[model samples]
Structures are given as C-alpha cells and as structure tokens.
Target: MSNYDELHRFLLNAANVRGELVRLEESLQPIVHSVEYPVQIQRLLSEMAAATTLLTAILKFKGEIGLQIQSKGPVNYAVINATHDYTMRGVARWDESLSVLPESFQELLDSAVLVITITPQEGERYQGVVALDKPTLAECLEEYFTQSEQLATKVTLMTDMSEPTRARAAGMLLQVLPSQAANTDVKNDTQFDHVCKLTETLTEEEMFSLPVNDILYRLYHQEEVEVYPSHPVSFACSCSKQRSADALRNVDKEELLQIIEEDGAIKMNCQYCHSEYVFDSVDVEAIHNGQFIETRKDQ
Candidate 1:
C-alpha cells in the first residue's frame, strides 16, 4: 500500500522521467464539509482535487493551475484551483440527484470536456481543453497532456470514501523531460513505447492505496530511480474579505451603489471557500473614493 499522510517523489536516474504520489483524504475533507453532495459528486471532486494537487506540484513556476469540468448532465460543473504550494479549493454545482454516480465519467457527465488553465503570477494566463472521451478523469487528463502540452504525461487520481469518513486521494505522474532530444529514428520510439506500456499496467487501487516505493517498483523495478523530497498538499483556499474588496473596487460607482441599494448591502461570495463578504453603504462609498488604490490600478 502507498504511504499514508505524505507525498512521495521518484525519478528514473537513467531517464529524464519523474513521478509523484500523494494521499489527500484528510486534506480534502474540509472542502466538502459545507454541502451535502451526492456520493458520486463527492468522489468526483476528490479525484479532481487530488489531481489538481499533483499538477500543482509538477509546476516549476509561480502561480495557480486550475482544472475544470463542464457537462450537459445533472452535475453542471466542477472546478478545482491549485497553487504551486499545493494550496487548493473546489466547489461544484449540481441540478439534482446526489446519487448520480455512473460507472464512467462519460456516462456520469454528459459529453464533458476537461479544461486546464495556468495563470502565472505576473503573466497572461493560458488554457488547454480536452474532450472527456475516456472512462476516467485520469484518462481524460492524460489525453489533455498528450494533445495540449505534447508531453508524454500519465496521470492517475483515486479516492476511497467507504467509511470512517475517510477520503484518500492520490495520483502518480510520469513525464519525459521535454528538453531531452528524441532520436528521430524508430529506436527512440521503441523505448518510449516500452515505458508507456509498462505505465499502462497501473491500476486505480494500486495507485490510490499502494506505497509510493511499491508503486514505483511495481512499474519500473528494472530501471534506476532517484527519489526526491516532497511537499505536502491540502485543501487550502486563498480567499479573504480583502480579496473580495479588491474585486468590488472594479465595479463602477453607479453599478456598485445600485447593488447596495437593491440588497441594502453588496454581498460578495468567494466561490472557492463559500465565504460571504457583505459591504455596507460605507464600504461601497470607500470603494468609489479610491480607498483601495491598488485595485483601481488593476481596473
């Protein structure tokens, strides 16, 4: 079984490939606390949440990476946002049925698409979209990386919410070093193909519950591996009243005042944390008077 309560990192010393494993049952529980979501929806979010943490750890840049799914089915949408530090938060919208768990994401989500977005701390954002034409989120994400980033990235996400209110979600990612030159001849393709075949043999159970060492050894025992120190992940939300105020500062005075008058106070909700920020008439006037000067510059 995988190690509990920690993230594990491993690498192939001979190859330009690396992998990571994490157990996030406790880390993700708080995210689903405020709502009574269906089991299927909760499981889905757990998988996505786990995967987002994995993606966040892979990034060598500063900023946030978000994963989103939109379907024409009962569960209208789900999204998980994560920063490089493994800070994450998620929320979902469903029209009905907490028992909407289908055997497959395709069946559960009607014609869904997985979208990946990256927002650098100081640069423009970039997004990549992939069709959820697979049976699992892991496959859908793998498709995105194969097509969008052109990198040989394999991802697996899993969760166990059976009892004891336990929720364990973890993932393993394998990708080739993009900087390495690929042999144009058929030989390189043959070796890459071999690795892919080995990785394909991984299972959801093994990934979710197996120890990181066993998981890696099971897949690549024949190859040399270099393991690294890992950073832990949790269900962290980056929301606050100050951030809510920053967003409000962009609204025109008329629009701001109209909202305030209509509701007696301007209410802003943090979609990530579900925290409510109420702005009274005074708060509204201060916003208009350039009290949040930095926000004005943003506008």
Candidate 2:
C-alpha cells in the first residue's frame, strides 16, 4: 500500500466494540501548505484532518464533513473539510498582530471553540460545539464526542514537525453497540472505562507510523478482530474558475462593478487549494448582468 493513504476498521464480535486505524502522511501534509502556518497550527491541522477523515468514513453520506476551530486569540479560524471519499483540504486564518506561537492547542486557542459540522448531501447539516479543554487537540475531540454524542469515546492524535516535516495522525474509537447492554447496577460507564483502560496502552509509534494490522495487533491482539477493506485517504480540493464565476454572478451588477473598481479586478481565491480566479472588467460585466453578445475579443 502507498505510505500516504488508508483507513482500516476492525470489529470484535464478542465485545460489541469496534475500532478504526488511520495514518495520514502525504494525504494531510499537502493541506498544511495551503497557508503560512506555525508548527503548532500544522499540528492542529493534522489532528483535525485525521478526525474529519475518520468521522466521515463511518458516515453513510454523499456530502462532506467540516471540522472548524474559531478562536479569540492569534488564530482566527482553522478548518479542515473532507468527504466520504476521504478527499480533503484545509486552511487557517490568524490575526496579524499575533507573532509568537503559544504553548499548546488550548494555549493557542485561548477562549476559542471547536465546531464539527456534518453536511450530508440530501439532508440537513448537523453541528456540534465543544469548548477547548486539556492541552491537546485529541482531548478536545473526546470531550466533543462525549458531550455532543453522549458516546464513550477516546481519541489520540500525534503530530510531529520533526525533520522531513512529516506528520501522522490516527484515532481509535470504541463504543458499546446499541444492543449490547452493560449491567444496570454498574451503569453503562464501566464498559467504557474498561475500554479506555485497554486503549490507553496504545503507544505513539504504533499510532503514528504502523500499518493498520500491526497497530490493531498491538492494541487488541487478545480479542477477535475482523478487519474490513480499507479506504484511501487523500488531499483534494474541488474548486475552479468557473465555480468562482458562478459565485460572482450571484452578486448585483452594481456591486460587482464597484468591487471591480475597488480591487482593480474581481478576484476570488479558493481557500482550500490556494488557487486564484481573476475576472477582468469584461468578465465581471458578463457575470453581473448575465449578458452575452458573443463576439470574441480576438475576433
């Protein structure tokens, strides 16, 4: 298999618990290049990239999932978007006044919020918000799942800005299937506690660089794990000049003209891919008024 892509799911029949392993190398690193970001920001982007890929992989949807962080500190907004296909791209915005990077995810995102938005193509958009907790990105994700989904889930993400500028982010999720019931006397929490105990034994190297099978063996070799087919993860963006023109067409003619005069041209930049789309005066005029008296400029 290629070193840059893939997610594997494993299920243990007797325990009603399921797990997933995802390692993103080239898949997410390309996303980090979209904007000029600090090392800390790259780490956060890696974690969110992993999270979105894992979350969307489990969904039975045709649309996209967006993980966004909005902050009141140096970082204005950091967002990663992905789909069931695992195609992804991300970008972040920060305040210009900010110069130094903070100590941790929470430090960098002081007074910020993490929001997860799931947009299914044919249905409604669902969103969940969690206040930044603990020092790490993984902890914030666990909190979001517990509060918003009421699921007993644990997530561990590791980011390395070391030589080669490589990054690896992976996650393991466990929950008692609806049919599997815990003892009423002990509450459903005990099962989750037991799972967390086992899951905590996971090591950084196993998560960051190991293949799905090896990683699962390290974590759950004692149990019966049925591994399923894997899905490839990747860095992809859906943006183009035609789409930009379509967007520009939505604005009023006067507004488009005003924007052209002010900016010298109506330019739209895709945040995900860093692609530029420039509409000169004539292009802006066509888009605004929907007028097309076809006479080629060269003609």
Candidate 3:
C-alpha cells in the first residue's frame, strides 16, 4: 500500500463542480496510535482525520479547522484538527469497560451533535452544528453542507482499521459550484447527480491503494477532469515548551506551588502529540515573576 500522504484538487470541465481527494497514511498513524482506543473508535477517528483534511483543503484563509463530536453514549468525545498547512492531530475518549462495539453511529453516540469550527487568521471564527442523525460521518457532513452552505455536496470516507499496527484513511468530496444564472440550476443538478453516482461506485480497497489520478480516471473516465498539482499532508503538533509555559502563567500561583510540592515539579502534557513538559520550582517562580521560563521534556 502507498504510505505517502497527499491532497489533490480537480475540476469537472463540463460541469461547474469541484472535487477534492485526500489520502492519509503517515499523517494518521501517529494520531491514531497515541492512545489504545478500541478498533471502532479508531475507525471513527481515522475518518474524522480524513474528513478534516478534505475540509481544510477548501479553505480560502490561513487558519485552523476542527471537527468535534459531543456524545452521551459509549463514545464521549472525539476531535480532529487540521491547519491550513495540512498539519493534523486528533484524539478520542470512550468507555473502556464496554466490550461490544456499537454497530451504528447512533448506537455508538446517543444524543450526539457534530460541530464544525473554522477559525480564520483575519476574520471572526465560524461554527456550524448538525445532529448526528445519519448512519455515517460522511452523510452527516453532507447534511452540514446542505444546511449551512446551501450547496449540494457528497462526501465519501473510508478507513482501514483491520490491523492494529497499520492505519490508513481516505476521503473524497464533490460539490456543485454556485451558479449565476437561474436557467443553469437544472443543468448543474443533473451534472452533479451523474458524477455523484459514479463516485458512489468507489470501493475501500481502491480508495486506500490507488493513486489519485488512477482513482479519478476509474471513476470519471467518461468525463473531463482538470487535475492540479498535489499538496503534501503531514502530522504536526503545534505544541512547544514556550507555549506550555505561557499556559502556566494563567494558573493560580498557589495551585502551581501545591502541584510542585506534591510531585517536585509541574508536568504539562500535550494531548495532541503526547509530549510532556515539566517545570521545576524555579521555573514556576519565573512564571510568577513575569519572566521567561524554560522547560525540559520528560524522557
């Protein structure tokens, strides 16, 4: 299987429709292996990772986008973040005691809500919430696009969690572009439906193993697609010791002292990367005095 991670953009010359294809391997391995999650949860996280990557690629600004699931069932919380540069990280929380995995999204996440957040570098942050009424994450996301953007969108997500050591995810997005003429609405809808039907024939094996061009050709050989250069995707955490120290400044001094007294140092762990940062007594004092403080990684 190809382990390279990349995102590709394509345009349907015949129709006013655009598409994106994302394949994640190296970028998803670290995030999925950060914790010992159940196989089902791992699959969900992997799908979210691919979905976030696809969504971020369509952004017009420099910022971050996140997909968060808040539920009251076995799976409590799940989140995936992707930056404009394609750096990705994700985590999930679930009930460890549950022995049987839920068979459906509704069973796994009762009373769940999916939240999509977009933070632009220069404008106000935007968010949209959608009920998890669909059977799959991709369908739920399609609902989000229809309700929020008023654009017809189709999303397909596939994740291979069959092996504990090897993780792979891929997703494709197809959406109808905004039209200027009322007469073209019917024509655009017909084009979108025809292309979507072809996309629906894609399989998990092809999505995981096939190259972008091959996949596109196989699905849309009859149609003309204008393929563009691919963008590399990677797993990168935006966490650093300096950022950790800055976060410590917001903590109460007394609480910091108590933590130091109990453990001999204050430890802050980055949930995204699983990197630990430790601050000793002197370091805490520097933070209190409004001076720069340095921290050492926990070996």
Candidate 4:
C-alpha cells in the first residue's frame, strides 16, 4: 500500500511557483469512522481534511486553521480543523436518510457559505468567507485564493474508498509566488498557467498511490523541481478534562445543580475527540466554590 499521513512541499526551480502534496490514511480513518457517515459525507469530510492539511502547510505562523461549511440543504454543516503541528479532526452534520447522494455542491447544500478561520497562538485571529457556488471543493478554494489572497492558485483533491478497512485522501496545491524585480523577465501568469495545466493532468489513482517525488517527476519531468523533506501528519484532538471543566464553569449555577439532582451528574462531551467529562454533585459544588478539578471518562 502507498504510504499515507505525510505532506511534501516542492518548488519549481525555473518558475516562481511552489506546491504541496498531502496523503492521508490513519489520520483520516478515525474522523470518518467516528460516526456512521454516508459515503457522500465521508468523502466530503475526507476532502475537507485534505484541504485543511494543505492550507495548514502554507501558514507562516504558529496557529490553527479551520474550514467550515454551513448550509440549509441536506448537509447542514461540515468542518475540519488543523494545527501547525499537522494534527487534524473534522465532523459533518447531515440528513442521513436522503434517498440520493448529491452530485454537486449546489445539490448537496443550499445557500452554502464557506468560512475559513485562522487563529494564531498569540496574534489576532483572521477569517475569510466565500459562497460555495462552485461544483467542487477544489474550485471553491481556488476562488478563495484569487479573491482573498490575490494569488493564482490551483487545488486538486481526491478520496478513495475502494478498500473496506481504510479510506484515503490526497490533495495538491500550486501557487504563484510574488514577483521580484530581479526576475521581471519571467511571465508570472505564463508560468502559473503552465504549471497549473501540468498539475491538472494528475489522476485520482496517481494522487492516492504515487509517492510525492514520483508524482512531481511525472508531472514536471521537463522542469527542474526542488523537493523538500516530508512532514508527518496525524489525527489528534486537543480536548482535555481541564478544558471541559473550564467550559462547565460558565454555566448557570442553578442549572448545574438541577442537572446534578436530576441525572446524578452533568456530562460534557467533546465533539472533536468524543471524550466525555462527567461532573458529579461534588464536582459541581467544587466548581461553584472555584475549586474545580479535572475529571474525565472516555466514551
């Protein structure tokens, strides 16, 4: 089987262009298998995961990036989050019993809005929003780059579910670098168009099965490319008992006590990791007294 859970970056030696390729397997299985998602939802989640990974690689700061889709159609919402370390998690809410799977973005979502958020560890957070008017996620993302970043960008995403046990996703991104006075003779548009056209030749099978170097060679054999070391990607959730306890403290005291009295305890579930934090009367009392301690249970 082809190696997964890896991200590779490369630069076109002759053109002012850079690119990234990412393949996901183990990192994606837990997210897709966390709940019983239909094949269509599963595939969209995989693509979102791959797109998140690609976007995370391009960040210049230490932060977390998130891609979220909100709609009024069969698919209500979908989101994927990735940190600078490449840890990723995602989920989608949808109508499960739909008779037919959507064949296009417009079919799957109504009045859809795509939101991209970036929060740095210290600096201010940033957000960009765009309409999901395009047919594919790749085209929508490409529009974001053009409208928000003013850069010529191309994105290709693919997911393979042929294997029963493992679902795989892979994507590639190419962006034109800013022009420099020293290279005024190089036509940025021509270079970007050429590289983008070559990248368009990649097939789903090649994206999922070929190694990064092999794929680059196959696509740009006539050009000089400088490949970089691969970055490891994995599925990791940042949820913890302490975080859950802190969140619980924000609830009204009377409501907390009522829940404790009615159900014996107040349970908080982390949607990202599916971890549960149970707070009994004692814990609630401590929290009310500003002496709360972290307690956890895996569900």
Candidate 5:
C-alpha cells in the first residue's frame, strides 16, 4: 500500500542506528495553497513541513514541535508546527515588492537562524537555535543535531512542486541512538558512515514516488532493519471560533464594541489555514459577559 501522509520508523539492529521516513500528499495541499505564496515560498514551506514531521517522530514525549526559520532577508519568517501524532500546519511570508526571489536557500534567507522548539505536554519547553549557514535546509538540520544532541545526523528533504495544484513533500532522517552510543568504536562509526553513504544515493523520483519500505530496502538492502508500526499524518490547524474569541478577550471591551459598531462585526483570520471567524454584537456581548455563544466557522 502507498505510504502517503504516513511516517514509518525503523532501526538497524546491528548498526545501532535509527531512521524515519515521512511523505506528505493530501496533508500538504491545504498548507501549500493556504495563501498566494510564490513558487519559492511554497517550496520552502513544504520542506519545513516535511522536516517537522520527521523531527516529531524522533521525540519520545507527547508534545508539540515547532520548526521556525527567521532572517532579515527576502523571506522574513516561516514556521511549521506539528504534534506528537503527526498533525501538521505551516505558513510562510516573503517580501512582495521584490521582482525576483533567490533560488537557493542561503540566498533567500540571508543571515538566517533556524530555531527548534519542543513543548512537552507535562514538562518545561525546550528550544535550540543554530545559524542557518548551510546552503540547504537538510544540512542546517544536521548541524543542529550535532551541536545540540552531540550526535551525527543526516537529513534529506525533498519537494515535488511541479503540479501547482498537487504539491508533495517527503523527508528522511538518520541518527545514532544515544543509549547504544555510550561506547562508540571506530568499527561502528565506519558502519554508520557506510549506511549514510547508501542513503545519499536516494533520488527525488524514488523519494517522492516509492513506498517507504521500498525506499528503505533500496538504501539499506544489506542492513538488518526492524520496522515499526506506521503513524498517520494529517493537516490540522488549531484554530476555531472559540480560540479566536479567547484572543479577543484581551482587547478592551470598548474598543471591540467600537469596531463592531463601525463594521457591524469583528473579523479574525488565521494565516495558517486561511480560516475566518466573525463575531457580531451578540457574540461580542456574550464574550464580554463570560457567556458561551457558539458561532459558525468561516473558511
């Protein structure tokens, strides 16, 4: 069966290495088309969504993971947020005045910094930042793992934006298990490098079209892989009329009433999913009165 919108995890029992493969199809469409982003921005946002899924699978705790890139360049901000179950949503913003956008990652995000934030459901949140000095998103992620976790990691992020209406993205992650790496030997290190070399042979066609198992076999045909149950991934935005109302609670009631009086209603929009929520006088009054007033969600 096809592994579209699913994540598969595997471990090389003999080499003490772990791997994850994720492919996004239907889950990527809503995100890519959430706004009228340029081709470059679409590709970049897709890549980030794939990477966030791969990273979320590597975590042992149940929480949310956010991968963000910020810079003083053409693209000022981009972020992909994912939950432990692989539910994902993302958005990107770029300068519209520029006639041409850079085709390379470094050029598009000059002086950029990649930030990885993990917020556990029960524990304190953790965040790590690294300079986006590499030419590609994959390499910069590898640098992050090396610096923050002290482990050698390899990441491959690919996107198929050929069909404007049907975009796809996929990613693969390889890393050494910390528990099994207490006593690293030269032989084991060599084996890890060997496996990484094989992984480098993956092409865009195979990565985007082939099944997860098939791709793994093609790359690690000689290694003993212990595959785990696959997890389903989908596009889920954490936005709703109630959440929008909660945000409006912070604003002064008089100010909100003034806006409602002028416009007949207050409107809120979510950038991640292009969702619109409108609150009329009654809804606003109920909100201020600490009463529940259910309103329909606008798309």
Candidate 6:
C-alpha cells in the first residue's frame, strides 16, 4: 500500500515509448463506497477510476477529461471525470432487481459504448466514441487509442478487493510516441514490444504491494528509463450548493414552490458523493429572482 494514490509518468528513452502508471487506494475508497455497490459494480468502478486517472495525466491544458460507459445490460451507465491535476469523482447506475450481477465486463455492459470527452478551458471540446465490444475495459481503451490516434498502445487495469473495506486499483499505459512513430525502424518497434511485454508481466500482488519506483525498476531496470515527478490523485466532487441553486433556476418558479410546499424543501442529491442539498421556499424565491442563494451543504 506504499506510494498509493499517486500517478507517475515515465519514458523508456531508448525504446521511444512513453508510459503512465497509477496506483489508487484512499482516493478510490470514497468513490466506491458512496453507494452500497455490489462487489461486481465496485470492481468495475474502481477500474474505471484508475483508467480515468491514467488518461488525465496526458492532458496539456488546464481542463478536465471524462470517461463514460453507456450500455443496455445490467449496468446501464457509469461515468468517471478527472481534471488535469488528477482530482477525480465517479458514479454508476444499474438495474437493482437482479440479485446477482455478471462478473464479466461484456456481460455487465451489453451493447455498450465507451465515450471519451476532453474539454479545454479556452478551446472547443473534443469527444471520441468506440464500441465496448472487447472482453475487458483495458482492451477497449487500447482499441480506442489505436483507432483514434493510429498509435500502438497497451493498457492494463487491475483491482484488489481481498480487503473488502480497503479496496484498491492500479493501471498502466504504454504507447508509442507519435514523433517517434514516423521515424520508427524495425529495431524501434521491437524495443517497444519488449517494453510492453515487460509491463504485461506485472502481477496484481506486485502492483498493489510495491512503491512506484520499485515497480518501475523491477520492470525496466535494464532500460534507460526516465521517471518524472509524481502527482497525487484525490476524490473530488464538482457538486456544490451554489451550483445546485443555479440548477433550480431552470425550472418554473411555481413548480419549485409547489415542491417546497409538499416536501418542505427542494432536495438535490449528488449521485457522485451522496451529498444532499436542500432549498426552502425562501431560497427558491431568491434563486428565481436572479440572486444566487447559498444553501447549506450535505443535509
């Protein structure tokens, strides 16, 4: 569990490949426990969280990246969002009638689509979509990279739930740099394959139990590896009282007042963190009057 909740970026300079490794624990616990998720859902969500964090580390702008899976299987929807700094939050929805959910990714998310969205602070938003036809989420992501970027990529995601209460997840990404792709020779391609093969040898026990540098050294000690400074990843929800109040302005004032009269307050609950926001008649009145009323958080 050492060096947990951090994302590390490294490069095998000689191989002309860039890699990202992330191990998550404390940050993942809160997201998975936000609801009474079954073991199946918990593992899937944790993997998605790790995958999102790994993808976020490549952002060059001050914005956010969102990964969403939409399907018609037992699990209808799941989404994870992360900012450039590695702060993340996620939520999932599934059919509750089934007592036992399927353990496989494709079984749980039949007829699914994986959507990757990137929004820059000052530029147009970009989105890429690929079918979730692969057996594993990691392979689906690899497919996305190969299709969209035309770059050879490999992704591996793992979760450890032996300790039910203190679950953890980690992921690794290896991709050929586009700048190097144009000039890649047979030897360069062979080196890239060698690096990917070494990464594939990682075991769940070694990934969860060892530190970042130790894991890298064990896998790439013989290569010219350059590791960068690590960044901490945390669970951070973007929901807020003010934002909830602003959302209320969209509805007719009379409708909100009616809800207040019946339920005593207009309640808004954040699915990501399960935080409740309550707004009374007065708050509604202020909000409809174009005044942003600040309500109490987490009722």
Score candidate 3 by lDDT: 0.86
Write down the TM-score of every candidate. Answer: 0.84, 0.87, 0.94, 0.94, 0.95, 0.96
Candidate 4 local lDDT, 36-80, one digit each (tens)? 887888888999999999999988899999999999998999999
lDDT of each: 0.74, 0.73, 0.86, 0.86, 0.88, 0.89
Worst 10 residues of 6 by lDDT: 180-189
Quote the RMSD, in angstroms, for model 3: 2.2
By lDDT, the candidates rank as 6, 5, 3, 4, 1, 2
Error of 5 at 23 (Å): 1.2
Which pairs clash in model 6?
none
- Judge candidate 6 at residue 205 and give its lDDT: 83
lDDT of model 5, residue 258? 94
Enumerate residue pairs that collide in model 4.
none
* Model 5 stretches with alpha carbons more than 4 Å out: 182-188
lDDT string, candidate 3, 1-299, tens digits: 55359899999979778899988888888888898877788888989999999999879999999999999999999999999999989999998888888866778898999999999989999998989988999999987887778778889998887778888888999888777123233345788889888999999888877877889999999898999888899999888888888888999988999999998988888988888888888888888798864544563
Most accurate candidate by lDDT: 6
lDDT tens digits, residues 76-166, model 5?
9999999998899998888999999998888899789989999999999999998999889999998788777777787899999899988
Error in Å for residue 75 of model 3: 0.4
Evaluated against the true structure, the overall lDDT of model 2 is 0.73
- The residue ranges of model 3 lying beyond 4 angstroms of the native Cα positions read 180-188, 293-299
- Model 2 per-residue lDDT tens digits across residues 1-299: 34347887778666666677677888877887666677777777888888787787668869998989988887789999998788988998876676788857767777888888888989999988878767877777767766665555667666656744666666666655555533222145565566567778878765666666777777677777788988888898888666777777777778888887898976677777776777777887776667634332110
Please write out the lDDT profile of model 6 over residues 18-89, one tens digit for every residue. Answer: 999998999998889988899899999999999999999879999999999999999999999999989999
lDDT of 1 at 138: 89
RMSD of each: 4.3, 3.9, 2.2, 2.5, 1.9, 1.8
